[model samples]
Target: MNVDRRRRRIVVVGGGVAGVEIATSLGRRSKNDQSMPAVILVDRDSAHIWKPMLHTIAAGTRDISQQQTPYLAQARDAGFEYQPGEMCSLNRANRTIGLAPLHAPDGRLLVPAREIAYDTLVISVGSEANDFGTPGVQEYCFKIDSRLQADAFNREVRIRMLQSVAQEQDLSIAIVGGGATGVELAAELMQLTQIAEAYGAPALSSRIRITLIESGPRLLPAFPDDISQATEERLESIGIRVMTNSKVSAATTEGFELDDGPTVTASLKVWAAGVKAPAFLTNLDGLESTRGNQLVVLPSLQTTQDPNIFSLGDCSSLTLSQGERPLPPTAQVAHQQAQHLIRHLPAVISRGKRPPDFNYRDFGSLVSLAEYDAFGSLGKYGLFKGTTIRGRLAQLSHAMLYRSHQARLYGFWRGSLVWMVDRLNMRLRSAIRLD
Candidate 1:
């Protein structure tokens, strides 16, 4: 509780982008120092995968093996300890976290519930697909909130494609939510269908039907209207149906039941609607949170009630001056927050002074539709400020975003090597098939 002392131990919750970024930054920042905090990263998964690329995995465009980085390896390489345990509860008063017992596949307990004390804490447990309390959604719909969930959906798509080919019946696929995830997934599904047909599943293409259901007026509601319209046109050209202003009230065994009293039958159902922080965070002690269950944090990225506890990414909401609402849940925001905290956290750790406020820049948005096309706004360019671009340039720019994150995480040389490796792997491997 002393201000002028260094933290002996620090624990970072969540192994996603934000957590890894913060942990890696802390290691880099404290490299020259003799006395540094021992950093421990706690996550439920054994490996880390870029959440933005989940759509590609589900579409079979990118293999999970290629995209995934082992958390243990990264932690070891980055000078941190990795703990593969879920955070069950947080006792702020005691400065300890209660970890849930980890279980083996065979139902045996691997690790018992344990407590870990920390001098500083960072919670970056990312969000999950919110069903908006739709009836029967939890039971019937496939949610692409995690790698495991994405894999399951991909497998189901493969099975359905095979079934369609065997029976010569239409294989209907329905995607709920028209945000980036839903739009990108629709595009990926189209690509996967093409690949399946080219790879000895000719009958599959004719029977494959993709439908996007959005409760809003257009797809990519976060972007400009022109970009959204362009995406809609591209989807239509590829035989994917776009249903706007259609809300899914419930999910039945076969498909989604619409709020307008119509049932859309599909062989596979995907729920990408909205995002909400994990429910556990909402009821955690007296921590301040928004209506959507996101932890409310000051500009310094510290929780309102406790300066020892910091939060970032989708798990936390920081209001910005440019926008009336909180910053949108995007990888760019998380990456920026990580960079901001990395620069200022040392002062707070040593001097007990709140760091300078962080400002989030609006760098525009990009949406990729597989290999077909990409479109987005660049947010004030040259003389044409607030101009939007589309086609190849947009696609290239869209990909660079992921590369930028990799650059920060793996550094310049290693990140470039990994990027080259990904390209080589893509060329060497055969195109993935849906069947």
Candidate 2:
């Protein structure tokens, strides 16, 4: 792999929130400076979508077509080059990354493997659900770890719902995990009955059995204990069976088998229990990595083994101080890291300046349970310190996370237009995907 020497090149592997954000920012800046770095964004997928919103797509609460932004269009608008392929290997000494071939839906190879040279590399490959080697999890349980998985889940949901209604039988859905994704997904599935009723199947909600299983003693162990208790109460109140302290030892074609005793029976099973970085990130190309496969990075977000190669998002592990816990894998942390790099990388790349140490501020966490309810905790701050909120106000705040990300990516005016379009679309379109 080789490139023109007139300008430095920044290669961003993985087009997730962090990767895309940094690439777009640096790429746009390059438009003004003749010596500015050329940005090349490589991703496995052809488009981008907020990873947090994947569960919504899985539950048919969102339209994938509208939510996704084509990588080509984003690159054209933000002044970057988009390459389609998944990074297969990183060659640190050679300053290049080998990418896998791109293939069509029909399995024909569209582009052959190649290596891309880079002066600087940013890896934000993100994380995926870890089944912890549980038996049958990979074979039987569905996961909403990517857009394609979410789309497939949505199609399965529509088909299953239709079959259940036609057979006049209950559709049992068991979700393993009490994290935000699993909990929020349970809520969204509840909304399906309402959608069905509106479309013809009255009282369909009663026929859909959803059970949420958690190994921990409580749900949302990361949040304050009160939120966990309240969330369980809320879910139970809405007929969502919450099973705590129940470790799923195995997932079968029928459902989850608990370690201690009973087996939960369900036609559809989803695993959202935990997450770990992609296995390849573990000591990848001689770079250090965590036991969970997250890349070990300096506070400045640079990989410990090589300053030129940086990592962020769920794939990177960093602790602000020794003995302290590494930053949690969340959208907020990824966004802040991307912003920190965006703010300092220009000077760092061009003037040989030392990038400032990355400091992450926890703004708190929010959980929205579809239209039924929402909850949140205001982060460590002033009068609002650890403040808790729920209901409509909380729901609105939860919705703002994606909106703010949209505003950041599309600027204020266009983002506002998107918000308006979403509101209009909600009223004019079916609340659920029938196909």
The local lDDT score (0 to 100) that residue 234 gets in candidate 2 is: 91
Candidate 2 per-residue lDDT over residues 183-298, each given as its tens digit: 99999998876777788985678788999999999999888898899999999998899999999999998899999978999999999989899897875789999888899999
- Candidate 2: the clashing residue pairs are none
lDDT per residue, candidate 1, 1-435, as tens digits?
111234477789998888888887776555446366767888988888888899988888888887888887877677777887999788989999989999998999998999988889999999998998899888878988788788888888878777788878888899999999999999999999988888887667778889999998898888989898999999999989999989888888889888885788986888999999988888677899987889999888889999899999999988866667888898878888888878887777777777888888777788899999898887643465578877889888888888877887789999999999989978888777333
Error of 1 at 245 (Å): 0.9
On lDDT, the leading prediction is 2
Off by more than 4 A, model 2:
1-5
lDDT of 2: 0.90
